[model samples]
Target: MIKVIIFDLDNTLYNEKEYVISGFKAVALFLAREKSLDYCTVYSSLLESFVINERGKNFNYLCNKLNIDKSIIRRLVDVYREHYPEISLKEDIEMFLLELSRKYKLCLLTNGWLLPQKMKVESLRLDRYFDTIYYSQQDGLDLAKPHPKYFMKILQFYKIEASEALMIGDDPVADIQGAKDLNIPYFQISNELDDNEKQKIMQFLHNNI
Candidate 1:
């Protein structure tokens, strides 16, 4: 029986792109005021850099593209990552979590910087729903999901067998593969679910999980 439900924190629980867009807007405004750049241009350029390079490289990419000094990259990246994002759990997902928590031990396993991920949890007011939470940066370097040790750590800490846990996440490689590596069954969330799909999943949880 699945006694514990482990969730991925980013796109799984809440839309992570909301956090990215919030950061981009903040950075755009900051550059426009502090550096005398055009707000629209700065915002659009940052968005493009984000899309092209994804996360870590965006700052350098933007700076290089705009001929901005390398020194500014750190500040921009810090602003992006450290900003308090406006995010929340969808009402339906919130209800699902509430219902699930009543029956199963709910925990979160995520891979990211500590403060930012924690801030996301706080912003969504989701801290109360989770029995335990783990972050990659909480321990040592490179101890994130996709690593078997990370999955094993959670199981060991909770004293639950792989078969007794169900992992639900959006990432195929990180969440699904990590769970599979340890022989734990998993559910992949690809997109937003409608009411009927939610009901079907709930039925599956009730009947089989």
Candidate 2:
């Protein structure tokens, strides 16, 4: 039976795109105030760059476009990473988590820079739902997702075998593969948990646990 439910933070619990857009807005506002640039223009440029390249150098694109010093790119990155993200969980999520928390030991295992990940967790107030939270970077990037170290750590902490835990996440390679490598049962989920997705998860739980 499944006694532990491990969740990925970025795309599993909340919409990660919302966090990205929120970070971009924060950086854009900072640039506007510091460089006296147009806020909308800067925001649009950042969004366009992100859309085109996904996770490419968005700040570099903005710096090149605005003829700003490349040295300031570091500051822009810091602004984006350290910004208090304006993000929210889906309307159904609070109830879902509340319900799950009663039945299973909910833990969060997310891979990202420590500061930004912690900020995201704080913004979403995930501590209320999760019994334990593991930031992969806290251990080291080398032991991040797809390595299975953190997954093993979570299991060890809960004093449960891998079979007693279920890994729920969006990333096929990072989240799913990590759990797989650890011989843990896992459920692949979408970035947004719609009604159908929620039903599917419930069915998976019914079948597995």
Q: Which candidate ranks first by TM-score, i.e. highest?
A: 2
In model 2, the runs with Cα more than 4 Å from the true position are: none
Model 1 CA lDDT for position 121: 82
lDDT of every model, 2 decimals? 0.83, 0.89
Estimate the TM-score of every prediction. Answer: 0.85, 0.95
Report how far off residue 197 is in candidate 1 (Å).
5.2
- On residues 82-106, what C-alpha lDDT tens digit does candidate 2 reach at each position? 9999998877998899988988899
Q: Which clashing pairs does model 2 show?
A: none
- Candidate 1 lDDT tens digits, 69-139: 98988888788778888888899889888988899888888888888888888888887688888887787
Give the TM-score (vs. native) of candidate 2.
0.95
